[model samples]
Structures are given as C-alpha cells and as structure tokens.
Target: MNRRRFLRSVSALTALTAVEFAPWQTMSAFAREVEDFVRGPAVKDHPLRRISPHVWMIHSPDGFPTPENQGMMCNVTFVDTAKGLVVVDSGASVQIGEMAIRQIRKTLKKPVVAIINSHYHGDHWLGNDAFAAAYPGIPIYAHAGTIREISGMQGNLWRTLMEQWTNQATVGTRVVPPNTAVDHGQELKFGDVTLRIHHYGKAHTPSDICVEVVEDKLTCVGDVAMDRRIANMDEGSYVGTLAAYAALEKNAGSTIWLPGHGLPSGQVLQWNRELFEGIYQPCEKAIKDGLSMEEAKALVLKDPRVASRAKDTKGFDSNIGKYVSLAYLEAEAAAF
Candidate 1:
C-alpha cells in the first residue's frame, strides 16, 4: 500500500481499538491485517469432484503459478475413509487450502484426519499451514528427503518464489513442512481404507512419494506423472523415472493415477513415460552419437511421441528446452 493509504487504514484501526483490548495487542493485530489486505486477493472456493470410490479432488486448471491462479496450481486430493479424510498434497498455499476446506465442509463434512505430502515442493505442501490451523496436531506425512528439504532452504525459497510468481497473492503463506516421515512399502491404515506409500528411488524428486489407495484401486502420483503435461526432470532422472514407472506398474497395477497438476486416469503414468521417453531417448541417442545438447533437443522435438503431444502439453513451448537440457545431461551422465 502507498504511504497515505497505509496511514489511513492504521488510523481507522486505531479509532476502533477498545479500552478493554490491550493497546499493544490491537496494534500488533492491525499491522498484520494491513499486510494481508495488500495481498493480490484470496482465492475463491474451487470445485471438488470424485475421481474414484473414495478419492475426491480439486483439479487445478493451470499448470503453473501466476497472479491469476493465486498459486492454486496443484491438485488437492481428499481421501474419504471410514475414519475421516486424508489429504493427498494439501495444496499450494494457505488460501488454496482454506478453499479446499470449504469444499470439504460442503461436500463430505468430514474432518481432515491426516495429510500426505507428495514432495517438498511448496505447491504440494505449503497448505499444511491451513490444515494444521484447522486441525491442530494433524499428522503431516512425507518422505525423509521431502521432510529434510522442506525443513531447510526449500521451504523459505519456495515460499518466496510463490509470492513472486503470484505477485504477492501468496504473501501470507507459511512454510509448514511435514512433521512425519514415511517411506516406500509403508502402509497407513485409516479405518477401512489403506494408503500404501511407494517410493522408487528418484523420479521427479528424491522425495517423491506416490500414495496408493489399495481398496479404491487408485494412486496419487504427485509430480511423478502428469496428465497431458511433460514432467519436470530438473531434479530428477529419466532412467530412474522409467524404472519407477515399471516398479509402480508391477506393484499398483491398473490403478487410477491421480496427478498433482492434471486429470487422474489409468493412462497417466504411461502417457508421461512415453513423453519422457520421447524427450530422453532421443537425448540418450544423441549423447551416444557425440552430438551436442542443441542437436539432442532437435531430435526430441521430432520424436513422434513428443510431436504428437506438443500442441496439448502445457508450458511445452517455453519449458521444453530446459527439460530437454535436463534430460540430455542425465543421458550424458548415464553414458559416461
């Protein structure tokens, strides 16, 4: 806010302060209210839809954060179990989480019993703040790597990036990292439903954890796979990701894959695997052929698997080069 506007607001709050209220407390609260008022705007309640027998999700239409999206660029999946509700990837920010809570109250009216973070990315777990506030001492779960990164620089770094991306829309968001650590092959039971945690080394990130709902035949794949969108392998491995897909297929066979950014379907993993293959196989060949990164990118673009989905992939034009470079490096590292 401008100096004049801020002064006017402070004056109004000062006038409203009551004798019973402590002067310092009222002033402190007013300072916070003023800071909140300047944020881009609160996100409106997003609609929730059921994707499986027990999983309901708020699918974010956008693929990345922007002022327009208010940092609501990740899917908020709710697992309705016999016990209560288990949140898979809380959401992007506190505002987004609050919106999810609104939908929960309107639809299921169930208490959020637990939260599982897919990775350390802020968009996947920063909403832990809202849930923690609403359900005090809620058990927030994640992989050991995820917990470590989020508890360190990744937490504040993402918090700042979200604010910058949303132009202060996510200003009030806090970095509330997961409190509990889960690992591969861990099964968490919530009444009748069972959540099986699967972590096959590193795919999207070392911390990536896909939660499989055994009874429902569905798995929340986080960024390990996305529908109609290329996965970010910046902090990942193409060879490792393919291995993960193979492992996941063998274990959670034929289950619906719910992504953090797109629609949930049985074909999600296959689609992303093909897309990554299109991007990485070409790079792998190029590296073996002694070609440069630029040549590798050319082959990736020409690959039918990549070409066919080019028009439909979100951020394909702007982000493909970076992802191609990442794949090329991974391919080179593997070859060496």
Candidate 2:
C-alpha cells in the first residue's frame, strides 16, 4: 500500500479503536491509574533511587510530566577516571539533567568530562544543554546521524511540547549538538576505563549507538530495551531494529543491560529477542493474509505475550496497529 493509503487506513483504525475503546473518556482515568501504578503503594521520601553503585535511575512520578517529556526517566552513569567523569543519557529536560548531575556530584565531585547520547531522541539529548551550562567546554559524543536528526528537529519538538504542556513560550531555543560523531566503532579511554561506542545504523532512530564500558561490563542501551509494554517505532526501521538487536546480543554479552526506562537487566538480548518475536511474527502473518493493520493488531493482541502486559487491550490495538502498518510497509518494501 502507498503511504497515503496506509496512513489513511491507520487513521481510520485509530478512530475506530478510539470510539470503541472510549480512549478519550478513559484517558484521564487511565492516566491516574498509571500514576498510581508508578507511584507504587508506599510513598517513599526519594522517588528517584539509585540502581547500582555508579548508576542512578530517576523515576518520573507523573510518568511523562509534559509534552516535551520524552517518556524517559534519566539513567545517569558516573565513571570515575583519572581524567574526569563520563555521563550516559541525560534526563528529559534541562532541569532534570541538572538535578541528575547534582545527584551524581553527591557521590563524586569530578567535573563531567563527556556525555554519550544513545540516540537522537529528545529525552536523551534535551538535557545536554543543562550539562553544558553547568560545565562549559565539555565535549559531547553521539552517532553522526544523531546530531543531524536532532539538530534538524529538536527545536521544533521542544517548542511544540513546551507550549502545550508548560505554556512557556520561547523561540530560537537551540539544543547543544554533539562535538564528536562516531560513524562505526570508536573506543574512548578516560584514565582507567575504556568505553567502546558501537553505532547500529537506523535502529531505534536513524543513528542508534550502544555504550559499553569494557572493564565494568555494563552496556547502556538507550531505548533498545524499554521495560514498557511495547517498543515505540515512530522513528525506527523494523528490519534495522531486528539487526540492531542482533548486533547488541553479539556485543553486549550477559553483562548488565541499562535501558532508557525500567529496571536494569542482565538479559537484555534475550528480552529484545522475545519482544521481536512477539510483535514481528504475528504482524507478518497478518500482512501475508491481506488483513488490514487493524486486523493484524487484533491478532497480535490475542497473542498471550502481548495480552499479559497490555494496559488496555482495546487501546493497545490502536497503538500496535500503527506499528504493524509501519513494519508491514518495511517488510513489503524489502521483498521488492
């Protein structure tokens, strides 16, 4: 199907599901429910908690607080080297990023020497400005395409979301771009630690790089292994995503997998493999059967794996249908 037809079909499916599932009516209620789920039963003094000795995971009490919210709680990793410190993905905003930096400083007082963006997603890079403001002249690293994509779209995305959510308006707000771009493989040595940056082309985004600290054996994967119900493929390629997972499995081994969201895991590759199989196989079957994206979504919904974690099965249908449409398009294009 052509892009226009495919988009129209997806829109129709969205509308159908929205009406059938009462998404609008339930949106507020569902948000409250999710808020409760995330907040947990007990009210802890510090919601933002530390995961490992060097890694801290900032939990968003309201989940995503604003439109500018990239649905990422910060995953800040502190590397103490003879030179200085190295930070992984910053939080969702400048404020949060600075907060994370302060939290990191509580442990170690070294200046941040460098930052490695896992991908071009706003949530991962929006906090770069805060880090830069705190420590000027610090070099940032990312995949070449990540810099281009974020530079092209970050301003608009930040503005649009800020207006919708925060009601604070400012134009010409520039996000700091990466100073160094890695095309394929590059090793960064900071005093005693060596970090291997591997670029997996066109995976979660046009440029997705996984940061591996060799000595620590910890791989900080940005959005590759979100603990959420489904993977967001809005800016990702289906085939490339599979290849990215394969590459991650080969390179990361069984070390700790620090994802952009949720608790850190040691079995990231296995989880990613399961996610791919759960979503892809059914999606392909639906496409081959000439079923509409909506039908494919329903079929996938029936899968026990998806059903087990589905927030609202009906609403899940709409979201999964869109992903199925994109994957189907990619699969069909590949056949030619």
Candidate 3:
C-alpha cells in the first residue's frame, strides 16, 4: 500500500481501542467499495478440494490471521446443488471471497445462489460482501441470534478486528451480515440437495448452526468442534460444548465433521471430544478437589489425551492456560 493508504489504515487501527463498540469503522472509509466492487489486493487462488460427493472446500492452512495469511483463516466450503453452489462460509474478506469465486468458476462453473454462514464471525461471513455484489440478492442465511449479533455492533467489531489482525489486507471489505434467519431442525432443499440445520444452543457461540448435507452424510461443524486448535471459549462454555458434541453425535450419528480451519474427516468429532474431555474433565476434578486455577492448569496439561494432542494443536502452549481457567470457572459454577 502507498503511504497515504497506509496512514489511513493505521489511523483506523489506532482508533480501535477507544471506539470498539462504536460504529466508527465504515466500509466507505476502510474498504472504499464503489459500485459493490471491492478495491484491494486479491488473495492468490487456493485450490478447492472435494471432501464429499457434492461438497468441495478451499482449505486454509493457517489457523490465525496474519499479513501472510491475508485473513483467509477459515475454510470456504461450497455445496453443489441443482440451482447452484451454496456457500457454507464465505471467507474473511472480499479479496479472499473473490479468490473463492474465481476458484468456483474454474472448478464448478456455477453461480453462488445461496449462502449459509455457520456463525457471525467476520472470518466466516465478511466474504458476503463479494458474494452480495457478485450475485445480487443472493439470500445469505444464518441463525436468528447470529443475524442479530452481526446486524448489531458485532459486525463493526469483527470487521475492525479482521482488518487489524490481517494488518489491513482485509481493508475495503464491507460488513455484509447474513440476511436470512434459519433455525434448528429446518430443512432447505435446493434442486437436488437438501441442507438440514442443527443448533443445540451455545457450542462455539450462542447461535452457531451446523448445516448437514442429507445425501452426503457430512456436516459443516464450523468452530463448534474444531480440529488442530482449541476453539475460543471466552464467549462460550466448556460444559455447553461437551453437551453440543453429544447432541451432534446423537442427531447426526457419526457423520463426517468438517471444520473451518482443518482437513475434513470422520475422526474430527472424536478427536475434539477426547481433547475437550481432557481439558474440561480435569478441571472438573480439580474443582471438586478444591484446587486453584493454577493447579487445574497443571492437571489439564498432565492429562494423557490433552498431552497427546498438544504437539499437534495450534496455539496450544499459549492458549492452554486460558482454556484451563475457563474450564475451572465453568466447573466451579456447575458445582454450585
């Protein structure tokens, strides 16, 4: 970026601490979008790999946002239906979404007719800006609470967060939240494919919706049960996540689980379940023993299941202590 543009982006970053909840960040100033087209550097095309019969995904190798990753932190999935492609999660920015669009054209040669955002996180839905412009009036769907949060100040907070995290590569990306609200047990049929929605209340977030392709027997779990990294529990609950996993298994019955940051597999759920049990159950035991949070962290780190995955889990060293604290607090709260 030139000096003038760099200065503007830096100025926006500086204002983040003061106006975090305020709607100070606007698309016009940051994204400079004109005529529904985003003006920014394009993310280099990432190859889309097929996970199931009709589901294909562009995998993001990086779990965290950085200038090198360009905020392409979430996997963008496409479900080929009779009408067209149904996007599972758009992406983190217009540039990344545009890259997905280019890949879609090259592989499927289909238009994105509908979009289902798994949650309200900008990394999962900010790409809606590109799709909204590319496919006018394309119905973007999400859970009602997801829609409410994104439509509220969460959109601004996430947009600014993405911009700051990616160091302005996500700049010029408009905050286009999901427009349609879907609920648990709802089914939407497109041409030949049927998507069944599942929401078990507050797994990764309060309104996270998992979309299952009935014919394929695989579900997009989003951040609810991630692979290779711990899902952020700041706005979530450990007990609730464990419960959500149980509900998903009982409802879906061993379907392949695809996450936004890792490879798709049938083992994803079990892997996360074991890892989470290792993290949360130890805290539960610690709380029962009247141990401190630091003691709980030690117990969690020593759990075989947790230790087995620590080498492979992204950000485990830096994040495990915080996760243990959340688990300890949740366990203590549940005890009372």
Candidate 4:
C-alpha cells in the first residue's frame, strides 16, 4: 500500500478500537466515512450519522484546518422536530455550515426553524451565518450570557481566528448572534420534541448550555466533556466542570452524551472527572509546595500521570500545556 493508503487503512482499523458502541455508533460511522473522503478528492458530501429517527449528527475529524474538512471541528447535531429541523451548534466555518445544510436537506427536506448555540466558542457558533442566510428569520437560541458574549468583541475575535485557521473559510461568514436568550433550566417546545437547556454555572464556558432532548433521551453536551482528547481548559473551571457533569449524571444516568468533539458515549462525564482530578491534584500539590504558577505548570506537565493521559490522543497537543497552566492558576486562586 502507498503511504496515504497505508495511513487511511490504519485510520479505519483504529476507529473500530477507538469508538465505543454504546452511543453514537452511527455518528462514529459518519466520522470514519469522512476519513475515506479526506484522503482522496475534494468533495462536499460529508456523511451524516443517524442517532435516531429524529436526530442526526455529523462528526468532524480532529485535525488542523484543510480544504477537505473545511475546518469542521465540532459535532454539528440536527434534530427533526415534526414541525421543522432544529440544528444544535453550527460548524466552524461557512463551508462547513453549508455542508451541514446540504446534508440535512438530503436527509429530511425539512426547514431549519431553530438553531441552538451551545456556547460562545467560535467553532460552535461561527456557522450561524449559513443558517441565517438560508432561512432568513429563524430564531437562533443561546444562553443569555452566550448571546452577550457573541454580540460583543468575542464575535470579531472568533471571526479573525476562523479566517486564519481555515485559510479564509471565513470569506462569506458573518457574525450572527443568537436572537433568543435561553436561560438555564428553560425548556424549548418544538412540536413532538422538547429540548431542556441546562447551564450548570461555569463549566466549559460561562455561557455553556447542554441541550437534552426529553423524548430521545440524548443530551448534547458541548465542550463540557470530550471523548478522546483532553478538553480545552482555557476558558472554564476545572472544579465547576466536574460539578456540571456530576449533576448531569445524577439527573440523567446512562443517557447518551453527544460531546462537542469525538464520538458520543455514556462514560464521557466519568472520563472528564478523571481528567480534572488528574490535573487538579498534581497542580494543587505544586501550589502548596510554594511553587509559582509557572513553576507549578512546569512540574504538572512533567508528572507521569498527566503525560500518560494525553499520550494516545489524536489532537490537543498544545492544549495539554495550556491545561497545565490553567490548572496552576485555578489551584492558586483556590488557595485564597
């Protein structure tokens, strides 16, 4: 086999072992399908995984921006609410947003009446423009804090980052903030489907919201927990994140979780809790030992336990450094 073919073969074999079957089995299949497309030809057709009769999720690869993938980094979920389609979190760029629309059209021919932005993060919301352009007056819902963050300077900063990241995939992209501000514990009724939005204080972001489809028994937890890679700790609380996941488990045990990245699973919250403790305990010791934030960061990075946690992860090589630094700061602040 040639180098590219060999790599693709390796990718396919790895997928079988990497993805858990409990949740997102079809979603994992869609991701694997993309692997085939990524290695050859420029195609706009990224496969959609059927989570249920009413819900579908498109999984993006965990790699840097490229023309093939269109910088689609997050899990873009779509729900077919008897009345119309409700998109949960748009992709990272205009191309990806457009791709999602096409896939939705091909699958269900339903109008996209609503979009739920899970947080203020660019990768989760930058594709808002595509939906706004296609369906002129669709109500985009988000947490009140998320709406404020996107409407303010955060939108521009994210646009700039997207442009740089995707090599100008932001060409036609516009900054479209959520029109409807959804508060914590609010329920959005859409015909047969009712989505319960939860904001458990500051977890991934102050604006983070997890959407639970009451009937489907599935929760789309954006950035609150990840399947394979280490989640970004740049803008959220380590302790708060654990609390949010704990509340999720308490309220909805074994209900499938669709993470912001990676394959969906029932065990993600547990993995995230383990990841948080791994970082927190080591950094707390460094801080108690009179080490400065920078020193603590360095020591935490060198810890064998932390290093092993991310050894086999596909992406977030840089996030490990940022996570260690953030853990130090969080530990320092907790010292009070």
lDDT of 4 by residue, 1-336 (tens): 555456556766666655655258775766756444433322266789988657799987663455445577788999889889899999876667888899988877889999999999888998888899899999999999999999999998988787666555454567899999997778999999988888899988887999888788888998998877776767899989989988887765436888888888777777777777878878899888987767776776666656666776656476776787888889889998
Q: Across residues 72-182, which tens digit of lDDT does each residue of candidate 3 receive?
A: 889999999989999999999999999999999999999899999999888999999999989999999999999999999999999999987877788788889898999
Question: What value does the lDDT take at residue 258 in candidate 1?
Answer: 90
Tell me how candidate 3 scores on lDDT.
Answer: 0.88
Each model's lDDT: 0.89, 0.64, 0.88, 0.80
TM-scores for every candidate against the unseen true structure: 0.92, 0.76, 0.90, 0.82
Candidate 1 local lDDT, residue 336: 76
Q: How far is candidate 3 from the true structure (C-alpha RMSD, Å)?
A: 5.6
Top candidate, metric TM-score: 1
lDDT of 2 by residue, 1-336 (tens): 644335445655655665567767685665444333322111112234555444445554333334344333445555566788787876555555666677667756678999888887666776686789889988988888888777777645753563344322111123777778876568998877778886777877778888877776777777766655345788787678778777877875527877775556786556655655666677788767777667776776687766665673223545766767777666556656
* True-structure lDDT of candidate 4: 0.80
Model 4 segments beyond 4 Å from truth?
1-43, 63-68, 292-307
Write model 1 residue lDDT over 1-336, tens digit each, in one string. Answer: 844457556765664664346587776777677656654456898899999889999999999899788998999999999999999998888889888998999999999999999998889998898899999999999999999999999999999999878877776777898999999999999999999999999899987999999998898999999987777787888888899999999998646989999999889988998998999999999999999999999999999999999999999999999999999988888887
Worst 10 residues of 4 by lDDT: 34-43
Query: Candidate 2: misplaced stretches above 4 Å?
Result: 1-63, 67-74, 166-174, 311-318
Instruction: Say which prediction, candidate 2 or candidate 4, comes out ahead on lDDT.
Output: 4
